[model samples]
Target: MYSKVAITGMGIISSIGKTVEENFTSLTEGKKGISTIENLETIHKDVIKVGEIKLTNTELAQLLGLSSDNNYSRTALLGAYAAKQAVQSAGINAINEYRTGLISSTSVGGMDMTERYFYDYFKNEAVQKYITAHDAGDSSHKIAEYLGLEGFVSTVSTACSSAANAIMMGARMIQAGKLDRVVVGGTDALAKFTINGFKTLMILSDTYNTPFDNHRKGLNLGEAAAFLVLESDAVVKEQNKKVLAYVSGFGNANDAYHQTASSENGDGAFLAMEKALQLAKLDISDIDYINAHGTATPNNDLSEGRALIRIFGEKVPEFSSTKAFTGHTLAAAAAIEAVYSVLALQNNVVFPNLNFQTPMEEFDLMPQTTLKHKEIRHVLSNSFGFGGNCSTVIFSKN
Candidate 1:
């Protein structure tokens, strides 16, 4: 068995709210953050709604104490903001006190700046600085620099499942004694690239996203950053840190069945969930809630619904998707959902899966459409992404 990986602290900036407490309040009160695009200028502004963070690049840059001469992308700025919050919440005076690392993930590292300066980079020397920040790993490097973390920095980009894998990797590293503590999560800012990408897929919901509903249309794209501080049990005891929850189980599997589509039978989802249960040494009956990866996309809902049925059979726990409140946050989805899962465990309350109305015709599974009060002991959260990547993480109340 691997050493326990405890989530000591977490921070998030999403459409729903700017801080972790703000987000938790919005989530429990059934507040929706989906609205017309505000920060970015895109052609699809009127046609689509997104979970925008409501902070401009200039505002975020100011918060990060970056000068106008800096070239930090919106993704990097938002990531630094959340990461700093997590570090502060953990009450760590010296980040390098123990062997530490940072594993961040991003699908659109700096596309927001790239799209803005695509043509200006050649004509404007000031804009050329952002050119280097246009890769998958640049934002991660910036986050590590912000936190002064010097060892074992890496980035994962498995689309929406990226952050979950980052958390999983951090846990494994601690288990292998590679690092005593690690900051892991994902970040993505709104961009025309993703807006049009999902638009092309015909899965952009014009209104609110309703997951697993018969009348569901599609998903809303959102931008946010979330991070978790994972430390080994030994380090936790040595530092006397406050343990928020334990990452007792995690699993990752690939369908390899399609590039972006899930199997009809949800084979990849089933494998991922089963693997997580196995790692946690818990049974299906142990899960008190499931934070589903229900993006409300027709294909995803059907496929994820099938997977839930296969895993839980007739006694699925009360579950919901916070996506309705925060929109699909791409690389940040799993990380933010991890925060929500931990919140559920701490409060023993299951937040409603907003916009869920009717059950699907194919499966009998029904999500918790309204805030349900229950003693949530173990929560299973699923996050499936393109490239057939499916991941599941189980958080236990300690």
Candidate 2:
């Protein structure tokens, strides 16, 4: 059996809240964060709702103590803000004191700035500095610099599953004895390009996203960042850290079915969940709650529902998707949901799936629509992304 990786700290900044406690409060209070776009200047501003952070880019930079002249993209700003909070929460005075690393994921690294300066780069030298911050690894490096981490800094950009895969990779690195501790998560910011891209696909919901509902429309694009500090057992014991939860299991699989749609049978989803259960050394019944990857899109809810039935038969544990609360955070969806899973494990409560009224026409999959108190020992969180990327991470009480 692989040694369990302990999650000592977690931080998140989303539409619902800025801190972990705030997010928990929002969840418990049934506060929905989805609303019409306010930060990004998009043509579809009136037609599409998004879970955008209320803070402006300048405000975020101020929170990070970045100079006005710095080329910090919104993605980097959000990532650094949340990662620093995670470090502080873990009581990490010196990040380099341990063999530390940072694994961040983002689909839109600096696109928020690039789209704004795509035409001004040649004429304006002031904005040219952001050109180098346009790649996927730039945000990860910025987050590492913010945290004073030097070794094994990397990034993943497998679309929406990016953060879950980052968490999975962090756990594997710890199990393989490569790093003593790693901060894993993802970040994304609202941008006109992404909004238009989703609009072209016709999945941007105009109102609150109702996950798993028969009348469900599409997803509400959101901007947020979240990070978790994963430490090995040795490091946990040596540092006398307060363990919050354990990364007991993780699995990833690809369906190769479509570029933007999951397979009809959710093959990748099933395999990923099965593999996670096997690694956890726990039976399917041990998963007391599921934070499903319920994006509320017609295809996703159908496919994910089928996958749950395949794995759990008729005994699927209580499950719900918190996307309605925070909107679909794209690459950060899994990371934010991972934080929610840890919160559920720590608090022993099943977060409500928010905004579901009708069952699907094909399946009897009814999500937990109200926050229910239960003995949540284990939580299974799923995040399925484009290009058939499917991932599952299981968290247990430590």
TM-score of every candidate? 0.99, 0.99
Q: Kindly provide the TM-score of model 2 when superposed on the true structure, using C-alpha atoms.
A: 0.99
Tens-digit per-residue lDDT, 248-316, candidate 2: 998999999999999989999999999999999989889999999999899999999999999999998
lDDT of each: 0.92, 0.93
Pairs that collide in candidate 2 are none
What lDDT tens digits, residue by residue, belong to model 1 across residues 90-184?
98789999999999999989999899888988798878888878998999999999888888899999999999999999999999988998999
Off by over 4 Å in 2: none
lDDT of 1: 0.92
